[model samples]
Target: MILDSDTTKVISILGNDYTIKAPEGQEQALMDAVTMLKSALSETKRSYPTLIGDRLLVLAALNLCSKQVELQRQHAEELSRYEEQVSATVEVIEKTIAQG
Candidate 1:
């Protein structure tokens, strides 16, 4: 599935315009992500007023990346725990069936 450049939406971040294309049904999600990134950049700029351009963007990107990594780690741990519980449940069911 290929999206044409004409279908791209323009978003502004720190006064710069960016054109982004998303899957047919995910335009809203893409806009939502742009909003989140703009918010993050704005917050970072407020906290460090002296930073500009590349430095500001890099810091914001790093902050977002760190949060994303942490969330993924937590999700992985939760999935592991869920899998363990399911496995124990299956083992108990198998044992019960063997004993019947």
Candidate 2:
């Protein structure tokens, strides 16, 4: 089954057709995720020609999970930096107000 609409998408996985329906306002994100998963699976299969079945799926999942973890770590670090900058700016503003 091909993509029915923006809200409903059908992707072929492991010789089967899986349908995904995105909640309101998240169709694009869901579609992008499906595309990402397809790319990951294709790359995994290419990388390990001898590997198939559950192992291939597991490896692809693991790769995605690892990427998610790395992205989370980067986001946390960036958020911390933004927080520190805000704190410093607030301190300067407070000092100037007190002096005035």
Candidate 3:
């Protein structure tokens, strides 16, 4: 889990170069997520140019959190449907075996 010097990369985001050190297998995915966040921040900057860096980051994080909540809700609904289907199938199997 030690991401040392050689594993760090300088990524440019919102006109700043940030040196990010990610573990060996996670660098690309981490960079991609950063890139997407930067894009969201850039859009926020375009709409509110007077906002400070910290404010922009906060807004971006809020937006990301909202999306995560929405996704979790959807996943929960799907899981519930799957569980219902599994329960119905199990009941049918038990009934059929009892008759056999």
Best by lDDT: 1
Each model's backbone clash number: 0, 0, 0
What is candidate 3's CA lDDT for residue 4?
61
Model 2, 1-100: lDDT tens digits are 7754447677787887889888768988887888888788899999998888789889999999999999999999999999999999999999999999
Clashing pairs in 1: none
What lDDT, from 0 to 1, does candidate 3 have?
Answer: 0.85
lDDT of each: 0.90, 0.88, 0.85
Residues 1-100 of candidate 3 have per-residue lDDT tens digits of: 9636447888876578889887878888988898789888987788789987788889877888888999999999999999999999999999999999
Cα-based lDDT at residue 19, candidate 2: 90
Shift in Å, residue 53, candidate 3? 1.6
Clashing pairs in 2: none
Task: Quote the lDDT for 80 in model 1.
Answer: 100
Best by TM-score: 1
Q: Which ten residues in a row have the lowest lDDT in candidate 1?
A: 2-11
Question: How does each model score on TM-score?
Answer: 0.88, 0.84, 0.81
Q: After superposition, how far is residue 1 of candidate 1 from its true place, in Å?
A: 16
True-vs-predicted CA distance for residue 47, candidate 3, Å? 3.9
